[model samples]
Target: MYGHRKNISDVRTPDRFSYPPSPSPSSYSTSSGKSTSGRSRVRGAARSVAGVFVACFTPPEEDTHHHSSSVYGGVSDTFSSTSDFSGASDSTDGRKRGTARGIYGTRNDSTHMKEPGSVKFTIAEIHYATKNFALALKVGQGGFGTVYKGQLQDGTLVAVKRAKKIMYDNSIGGEFQSEIQALSKVEHLNLVKCYGYLQHGEERIIVVEYVPNGTLREHLDCIKGDVLSFASRLDIAIDVAHAITYLHTYTDHPIIHRDIKSSNILLTEKLRAKVADFGFARLAADVESGQTHVSTQVKGTAGYLDPEYLRTYQLTEKSDVYSFGILLVELVTGRRPIEAKRELKERVTARWAMKKFTDGFAISVLDPKLEKSEANGLAIEKILELALQCVHSHRRNRPIMRRCAEVLWNIRKDYKELLD
Candidate 1:
């Protein structure tokens, strides 16, 4: 499980130590000067052997413990009080000899180096990457916290959401953890990808993949003269509907995106819709009775909220459907979910549009920018019918996500055929 690969070039040992030629026998002289060369030769051989033994047995000055064994005899054991040869090896062979110092550095070899990829970004690095929480790079702000745009050294862009403590209450901390858990598991073309997270000190930052096209709300508000085409609007609606379907029924536990509005829906360069902001999402229980819906202060945009769910606080997948119904109205009518300036009865556009559809005045609610071409008008009617079904007052009456997806897909198919 734990191992490392070392470079062969970095590991090298000294070549074999050649001993000087033994001194000639004639070079040594004793008491007898006459032809004692034979005796001198014998003495000279003894001296050479003694020199080799001394060099091998001598311990380094730093060594404090001693134990030795001869490699040649395999039986010779010499113990010295000041030296420890516990890990030393003989290198008489012609092949390379590797020293512990050259391989790993320390004689005791207690410390191990961390692998190359083992060092992840530290808290400080993430802080620096985000410009120490600069205000200018902030992309969005919400109840949870502010999200800032950051770039890594490798030129990859990321959105870092720093969770702000709501009213100094730690209870909201659970929301941050929940968002992390939910986003890490969910992956789809319409869902945003969570890159990673940084929990440092009192701040918790969630890193996510950055999409360039900004929020659907911004695009709708900024682009004035040239409105989104009918086909583009339908395409966006279908994409967002599919995203909600994945969260509600595709996953192991159904997720309720409590907050689904124009601001929460992000767009890619191609205008593909991606669902963002899961701060209010919750997982439904597997067992029927195990599910418990929160009936506290309602949390959603005013006009887009499901009136029944809002009053009762009985949150469910249907609540998201109701919001999507309002979004569809936005796409078709080119209006906000709640237009305060409109007549008091027309406060919630979804409700108003539904009434208009029943009164056979649905065409009046369609955006004027949409051309009156035969194909466009027919497509608009089909989409209006689907949107009306989505905003049904009874949660049970609303179609399931799968059914919604099928309806939208069929609408797209029919519209595309008409254009052809």
Candidate 2:
């Protein structure tokens, strides 16, 4: 039982959630170097960051400050490149699909207004649900703010996210708007659902579905729950693939999940994976706009960021593909992208594993905790092969999310057959 606020240390990784701050005030000013008013500057910055971020619960740190942004330029819709994803698509049994807001002196007017259909929770109701933000109700914390577990009058369990006040002065306000915009537009079995939101004077709170199980990062760290078997890991991978696929292709305008790491992946009691946090999410370029990628500021975690995105500041769906590739390596090797404690050659887990894979020792990269078998070894090779394609240096070479999902389906089918 999580009786105390800090008791859920096992549920999240504190050191993994350090998001880099958004661009400085200079980035928000006009080309002439004229200083913009506070209102204009905030609005300009918010438009720049059309994404969301929901870091896992870490106890609030007084000295810690963080910012979120969609610093890149124009949005484009270019999900065109698709490599043949021919793989074993054997039919499998169907699985069940499962499915925020701020406070204020009540400033209901934001350039990024919440779309209709998203319930608006009054500040008073939020206070009652959260027991006035009592320490006991706290579930998670991060650079954005603190999260508390609450139950609504209708008996719906929700996770209420409260942004740090200082964050309002920076990009948190934009992050909040971007998250609402992204979450409000999409619904998928593998994505987290938004319940409502409350925005009081200085307080910004987003209410979301409560995921009982801890994050995938916690599970990989062996700090929470049961060992994740190869089969379970595969299922979770497919679930995530589905979520990303929905975001990239099914949405009215393609959405790019700027950040995709283990810490942002929350699991349900049934061990189903739900892609959480859209603070770093933004709309992709419009296909009809004759654009290719969203030229946004460099945003995303360190190891998982695409090399091309960093170099050119051009973002595409393949950016997510690159991160997913890293995620695949993480799942297979059960190692962080960067293991600071590792030796010189082994420090970067992805590169180290890729070397082992290319040298005809792919199985060597397998997590020692996993059982070694012909099926498992073969699955690892197949997965890393797909991962290799994902982490390709060029975005064009990386497979689309839909293609990745297809390949994973085949891999899962083959893995199941090998076991039989």
Candidate 3:
């Protein structure tokens, strides 16, 4: 789905010492055992950022407290491990919940959903909605799972996401439940709503409100003549920025969306963006008021991964900023993040556009399908400038999500002022 598949060279699997992975698309089973991708020999500076999550988590075979487990990749069996969600925030000072304005603010009032297993739907109801997972209802597929269009008894449409393995009874269930917990307490206009979930026999199904329009990636690369206007693309970018701002600043604690990419963003009839797939979301610790980052093994799609985070293994909210920067480049250029069929210099859109942008040809990156005008051209320049800052090699140079949203909102306002 990323693009035309070609033979990719082996880069080696991840390192086990990085710590056991939890349930979610990024999960890795303890059975996989050991990792040595040449990256392990990274210079001494790399050890300084080698992550702290390992202290709180250990592979089941090595620890007496854990049960054996596996997810799509697999997860840790212990509840106290990173496999389960738990962080302390004692108070909510900003952001609201369940609405657009102050959603992350709801932390002060959240009921604190402690049990994901409790939020369940019946399998029969799932069958009634998805018509028993008929091929016609299928909408998407990937390493994580398959998504299908479905309708509930009340006639409300929904999206049903099923596990890759038909019978994912035990270890994989960790990820199933982890996703539920992540989606349980929070609600936001820019977030995909989780209606509930169902489990029968070996099958685990997640039910979320259906957004009819399709993924942002599909809209960006449509084969038909239908083209997304420059204004429309700008709006989509703002919507996603707002959603990430909500996640980072609101909630009981900051939630790091390990994977932030165009394909994960779903669009509605209005083409509004909604962030989905929280299986890899992790709670930012509230142990200290000044905590700037969490140490965790690198886990995310290749093209969008943050270079700083990848080298140091010190995860931070800015990592998402770097990935969002890639999404911005995609929106402007209409190119896949990692297109290999092209020349090496042109393969990575970020690098290609960055070089062009530095040479003062940033305008060349705008999607040709979009109409041009003086006002829009100025707006596009500002967007590209912000994007370059986001993809900065050093995390300190990247703008925070809230600031990014505010900047995009100002760019939107420029359109109205210019019209007047």
Candidate 4:
């Protein structure tokens, strides 16, 4: 539990959190000496939530008396002395020696001190925010854990995911650490932002920027018995593709989002897609020499699993591509990846769609809810072609994330021009 208290300002009501006013654009400058005038214009236009602040820090150099308060609101909490603090480099350790605070307020060797920019959340604070994991706050449940909606004392909303018993007890903390490390390294508009993480007793919690719109699966199926518009579907596809492209090609280590399904894709209030759920994701160990395969247990939703990769247990970025293809099929056809309505042999929608496409009966497989407009027909065909290319049985035959992103972007661009 956290042990700390400070005077609270009485400027706002309990429902309205208050954040410190941000610096003006004229007051900011980039490391490149560029003024942040244009950047500020965009940022200033965003809806400001009370009590949320994004603070950047710089660790002191060696032998510098770096006096700092506890990172999480000066809270004093106990952590296991055996916890690994290997994330810091030798130089950072030398500088932070005797001045760093571990999770809660447990003092540790400077070696356990993390570099600046790594997020740290207090376990007691999160428990208070989520009302001790109240059932009403539960948003979604997955293989790894249940996600709950929370609000900080400042009233900033967040989504906190508590790892399941199996993942927490069996993984030796690797799963949570891996997710924090991977998410911290990447930043994209279409990817969910991880605010911080905490480890308390047997509980592991990840704090992320909350998306209010809900999951793609829920919007597609729960809201109405109708398929999404071609343009909206294409936009979601493009956003997700861009996010994946950022992970695979732009990062220091290529990341494979092992699970790529509607349920894992979240929508924002603006309907923009944000890819979530990194429990099954993995970062390619070597960036220069791409991995051909990775050995792991067969993991993934039934219909979305890549047949070749599942059989071989050899994973690569292509595995993600294949899963995305199944998702695309679901978007276009309005059918579950594995529809039990079909004959026993043709139950899998991907296999059935492929067969239908080959027989020149693709239109018959299109979601009936989608109107037979010219634009809709063209969009379906274009997306179907891309999906087919992605789900090609041969892993090498699948396009990389960059290509997939480009294709989707171009489709969106063309559709926009048509509308204009």
Candidate 5:
């Protein structure tokens, strides 16, 4: 329910999600500036990228020679335009064809890939599952289209994302494919699971496991009732961190979740948070060991986007950390990331939380309903401190998601002890 409305257009709208690019030498440089070496390493990475990229079936695209970083310091949000290449797609006569390179380095002629655990439901079956797209079953709305609450023949409940179809438009077609590429390959307790998808004519729908509870954002909203306790918030934090850590470190192919906000964090009936919506996820494989960041356009919710990433487009795992930091602030304060209704300085929760935290008034940012129990006080302060560090200006200063999770885990344990 926390998902955003995604579009197939590149007109700078909310749903026009773009893929992360492997940083080209001309496009990205370190804080120390190593342009000469950076280019040389990326050239090698290109070869490696081609090999793996071939195996991951996505729409194919010719190379995008976007070198727009020369302007605005070193931060180039070049792919923010309609001309942006989606890395894996090409526009020909129109209907985008899915392509793949199989295990033996042999190219497969099949338009669709059929890997184990990768399932495709018939259009008829999906129609029945979604109850013919009944309005009553609509669970959420986004740029992508309406999300429906569905049930399969076996009584398995699912969340079906009915993507907005465009006539002869190629942009959203690629976004839909990129989303499937990442979600189909990776699995983690903290990540949403994609069950299958259906392509019925121009209509595209992705079916995923339906999480019973709403989004973390909904839970945080006071209007939704004071349902989240301090412990629950901490648990959500750890869950998000673990999910991001899994994408960063545990995956065979590391992923960078370009969009990480409370809205993308869904809760199960148990309130276990699962990171959903891989609309902006990027494979971190094409990067060289030394050039860990991917160069992509700055595309994310305003307040959660990393200041460093926005300026540099040098997207790293740290970018996710920055967004997660904002999420932590949300948990701590029960506020939205961007609050236009608030005062000027307090408009951004992260910035507001940081000022308050650094000034030794971090306690002031706590949710009013948290009750300020003596036991959770110190732990809450520690969490706020960690979140402050995560939002540090320099990406280098932020702790990795795993480290963030460990700290939260410890705090949760202590909180549990206090409850006991």
Candidate 6:
């Protein structure tokens, strides 16, 4: 039932004003609201710099009884006088209303206003939610810091990411504020929701939605649950595409997700994906100002970083497109971007997989954990073809995130039709 045409331009892009439709059984939904007329002004600007994807957190146990030694007293007197988390109301209505200033800003600074839905959490409330950062409640840990499963007095569950002391003292601390600004501006179904943050003395913590299931990396490795079916993987790829699309097209400013690896992709109990971790995220250079790409020190994981960015230090949304290409290869091959155990030629999975794909052996690179079906075989070929374009050395050769999502939508539609 599907056409053999694999040309990127052959598949029509979804309306610029709207998002791609949600796939069947996926909780992620697209908003039908049309974007304003100016949306397409920078449509071609998508060729700009790359960014990393969000970070992932582990799931915690249900029990909340454990309580570690209180770290409250040391910084209590300092921030308590500034933050309003000690308020009596547990509901949003009772939360204090004040300007959302930077961690170092003064209390009465009217220069910075809080974004809607943004909250300023107290150290006491943070300590209570995380049970004093108890080891038993720890969910995930990464370069950013340790994540804990926490419950508020109102019984709302959240993932509390506490920056390590060293990270707080390093460049990552700046990323902390950068992430807060980035997270505050965007909201989408496939993106993880940010609840609030805590900045007490040496403690720098971010509280976000608690996604119970582990990360996409955990699932791909089969660490958290069963092997992901081809359909599930396809769905996740689309979900992430939607998230990136939102960041690039829908936000007031185009945001580049510099990191787009599997570990940065979090999964839910239903296997729907949410793009997390904004430490490496950045706003695209203002297209309105006629600037095309932002020039900055290169940052990102080794295997997933865009080559052009590394060589030239210029970044564009297409940089993320390159990383997404690497992620697609990882999903299909079930191998890390770099596999030291493999032969020299095969050491870089993306290169090896692309070689196989171009040599007319695309199906040969399919993840061994997946069973090969007629539909599955065809899907692999189409996906790799897309990945090929995405990973092209030249940024202009890559498809925009919007185009990527559209291609994936067609792939899923065709695959499901073939299965039926």
Q: 4 or 5: which has the higher TM-score?
A: 5
Order the candidate numbers by TM-score, best to worst. Answer: 2, 6, 5, 3, 4, 1
Candidate 1 ranges with C-alpha deviation above 4 Å: 1-121, 165-168, 223-226, 288-297
Per-residue CA lDDT of model 1 for 1-420, tens digit only, reads 001111123211122122224333123222112124433332222222212212222333332222211101011122122111111112111111122222112111111112211123557767776888788887766555677888765566777777665422443465566567677556667876666676666767777767777767666765522467888888899888878877776665667776677777778888888787665566643334443443333444445666555444455677788778778878888787767799965655655654454343556677776676656655555565556556655555555665666767777777778788
The lDDT ranking, best first, is 2, 6, 3, 5, 4, 1
| Sliding window of 10 residues with minimal summed lDDT for model 2 | 1-10
In model 6, the Cα lDDT at residue 251 comes to: 72
RMSD of 4: 21.6
- Model 3: per-residue lDDT, tens digit, 1-420? 111112223322222223121111111111112123211221111222112211212222321233222121222222212323333322332322333446433232113123322447788888888898899998776444778889888776878888878536443565567678778756777877777887777677888767777777778888322688888888999988988888777666667776677777888778888888776666654544544566654456656767666565566777788889889989988998767799966766766665555344556667877755665566665676567656655666566788788768777787656656
1-420 per-residue lDDT for model 6 (tens digits)? 121222222222121222122121121111222122211211222121111111101111221111111111111000000111111211111111124322211121111124522888999998899889898998766656778899887777888888878655446566778678888876666777777888878988887777888888888889989999999999999989888877777677778877777877889899988888776678876665456677666566657767666655566888888889889989989998778798866767876776565444667788988876778777886777677667655565567777778878878887888889
**Cα deviation of 288, candidate 1, in Å:** 5.9
For candidate 4, write residues 298-361 as lDDT tens digits.
4455556665655455557777888888888888777777666889535566656544543435
State the local distance difference test value for candidate 6: 0.64
Model 3 segments more than 4 A misplaced? 1-118, 166-174, 223-225, 287-291
TM-score of each: 0.67, 0.74, 0.72, 0.68, 0.72, 0.73
Clashes of each: 3, 39, 9, 4, 13, 19
State the C-alpha lDDT per candidate. 0.56, 0.65, 0.61, 0.57, 0.61, 0.64
Give the Cα error of residue 405 in candidate 6, in Å: 0.4
RMSD of each: 38.6, 18.2, 12.9, 21.6, 15.0, 14.7
Q: After superposition, how far is residue 34 of candidate 5 from its true place, in Å?
A: 39
Top of the candidates by lDDT: 2
lDDT of 5 by residue, 126-171 (tens): 8899889898998776555678898888787888888766422554
